[model samples]
Target: MNAIAVRAATPADHPRIVDLLTRSWGETVVVGHGVRYDAAELPALLAERRGRLAGLLTYDIGSEGLEVVSIDAVVRHAGVGTALLNAAAELAWAKGLDRLWLITTNDNIDALRFYQRRGMRIEGVTRGGVDASRRLKPGIPLVGDYGIEMHDEITLEMRRPVGSGIAQPG
Candidate 1:
């Protein structure tokens, strides 16, 4: 495997990111915090390996902190996700942010485990959050991977000082 290269996304990378999000989420509009974000327009970090787009992590940098709107690693278990996440956290710390956060559906046990192992903790859970999101996208499935029912949104947060390289309890 070639070494992974992570970098800030350029305007030319937008459509590819949109394509990835569309393929992964069934749409390019991500509804979160009662707002819909066009994933193609967001700031993102892209991961490249062997001249191929290996992964993407789109995020919102707000006054509070950074929110990971969507993340996809087409090449699974290849350190793509980790590289993108670290790059995002590095950006957050560079921007003087305090923390990073993201939301995953209830059925995404793999996501929960992955984020936790990376030092994130459950900050909140929006019961029936998918119901509200479905109203916006309408493509959200009633069921998800592993045949699990999708019902709620679980919020995960990492409260460590940006670039601390430490995962402390939130």
Candidate 2:
């Protein structure tokens, strides 16, 4: 396999990015932690392999930290997701941000494991949070991966030590 190239997304990538987000998440808008975000409107990173788009990660930078609004790899277990995530972390570190965080549904066991293995820890859980999310995006399914009932939102975070520079992924 060709090495994956990670880079900041340019405006020219918007149409493809919007298509990817729509296909992956059911629409361009994603609801997390009670906020609805049009991921296509956010700054993002793109991962390409062999000159083809392989993955994308959209993020929001705030005074508190950087929030990963969405991440999707077209090919699973191909390092595309990891590369996008690492690039996001590096961007956050460059901006002097101290933490990187994201929200995933409780039913997304795969995501929980993925983030945890990459050095993120569970920061909080909002029980039945998906219920409120449904108000914003009714397409959120009643069930998710592994036949699990979707319910809560799990917030996972990795904190960069003060003045420690970039935090490496585990």
Candidate 3:
């Protein structure tokens, strides 16, 4: 993790960032669902800051608010995720966003736990969402860890109480 600092993604980081996303997704969900997609579609969202592979994050503007479409921490378990999560939330709040949310596949138990520990709550479930997503990005699969069909997407959110510190719950 040498020189691996927690900074915003830069235009230069797009290649490495996409490489990370492609490799992460290719080995991850593709074989199960039997699909494919252009990883380049993700770079615009992973905009750069200080350069290097610090991390990647993208926002989704909705009627309700801006949601976190994707988040990639350069070094897992190095507080990188927390830093990014806090940064995203602060920006969302400043811009008057109602909440910040993201989606994770069913087999991502580690991520579920990580976000949960960071005060994010499982708000909803998208049954068959994975199937729908496969139409766009076929790399997703019906099978995940332990041979479980990755049939759903879990929606997570950070809800902030007005005038409270952070939107995250303990």
Candidate 4:
């Protein structure tokens, strides 16, 4: 198996990134925590295996922290997702950000498990958050993975320790 290489995404990668985002979320626009983000226009990290795009992570940096807008791994369980996430954390740390966070739907059990295993903890659960999100991105499905109804939004976060100067795992 080839090693996954993580790097910052450039303008040339935009089209491919948009395509991937569309395939993953039904479009390049994503709604989370009541805000709409055009994922293709955001700063992104890409993971490649043997020159093929294996995973992508788009994020937004704000006064509070860095928010991961979207993350997708084309080939699961192959370290692609982990590589992308680690790169995002390092980027946040380099920018002096103190926290990394993201919002995922409740029905996305895989994402909840994956983020938790990767050192992020559930920060909050907004009841009926997806219902509010659907007003922006109407394509959001009524049901998601594992035959579960998608309703709430789960916010997860990893806080960088004060004075550590590095992003900490867990």
Candidate 5:
């Protein structure tokens, strides 16, 4: 499999990056979800392979810590998603963040498994977070990629030392 490169994204990468996100997030729901975050929302990073953007992530620096606002990846089972995740974790560490976190839908069993495998622990659940998100982004459907109801948002949290060496966690 070809490898994807992870790096900070510049404004030039916006169009293509958004294209990938559009495909990853499902466009109708994205616009209908009624949640519109302009470019000023956060600093973004992108993963590319063979000069094509494969994934993207956007995060904000918050008083509490670094908040990952959105992460979109394509070509799953390839290294793009994991590479983006590893890079984001490093960014959080460099900024003295205590934890790296994100939220997913209540019925997202796959995401739950993926985060756990990456060493993230479930910290809390935002009951009806997706529903609230839909209010902000009217395009978000009542259900997710499949027919699963999108109600609660599960918050996953993970801490990394000043550096996250690839050693397996004990």
Candidate 6:
């Protein structure tokens, strides 16, 4: 397979990113920080392999924290997700940020494993977090992957001093 290339998304990538997020997340609206983020309009990083959109990651950096709002990969198990994650970490570290964080549903067992393996710690698990989120966007389904009821949002994070390398599996 061709090497994946990662870069900051351009305006032209909007429609495709929207489509991908819509299909991947069941919608294009992401709820975080008690507000909604239009994933397509947010600045993002895109990963391309063989000229195809391999993955995309959207984030928001602020004094509060750098939150990875969304990340999806069309090519599974091809390092697309990992590359995007590492790139996000590098960006956060460069900006002198102390941490990188994201939220995923409790039903996302795959994501839980992936994040932990990639050196992200389970910072917190807010019970009923998804329930609160649904109040903002009712489109969020009650049931999620593996037919499990979605009830909570798991917050995961990775932290390192600026200029220190992020951990990666061998």
On residues 57-121, what C-alpha lDDT tens digit does candidate 5 reach at each position? 87766665555667777677776767887888888777677767776777778777877898878
Residues 1-170, model 2: lDDT tens digits: 69999999999999999999989988899998889999999999999999899999999998769999999999999898889888888888888888899999999999999999888889899999998999999999999999999999999988886657767432
Assess each prediction's global lDDT (C-alpha) against the native: 0.85, 0.91, 0.64, 0.91, 0.69, 0.86
The better-scoring model by TM-score among 3 and 6 is 6
**How would you encode candidate 6's per-residue C-alpha lDDT over 58-108 as one tens digit per residue?**
999877567899999997898999999999988877778778899998899
Clashes of each: 0, 0, 10, 0, 11, 0
The TM-score values for the models, in the order shown, are 0.92, 0.95, 0.74, 0.95, 0.83, 0.92
Q: Write the per-residue lDDT of candidate 3 for residues 1-170, one digit (tens) a residue.
A: 24334444557665676676655555312211223324344322332235545566655556756566667665677666677777777777777776878788898888899899888899888788788787766655678876778888888888766886567652
Q: Name the better of 1 and 3 by lDDT.
A: 1
- Badly placed stretches (over 4 Å) of model 6 are 167-170
Worst 10 residues of 4 by lDDT: 161-170
- Give a tens-digit lDDT track for model 4, residues 11-99: 99999999999998888999998999999999999999999999999999998698999999998898888898888888888888889
Question: What are the per-model C-alpha RMSD values against the true structure?
Answer: 1.8, 1.5, 4.7, 1.4, 3.6, 2.3
Task: For candidate 3, give the lDDT of residue 100.
Answer: 77
Candidate with better TM-score, 4 vs 6: 4
Checking candidate 3 for backbone clashes, the offending pairs are: 9-48, 9-49, 10-48, 30-139, 32-141, 33-140, 33-141, 35-138, 35-139, 36-138
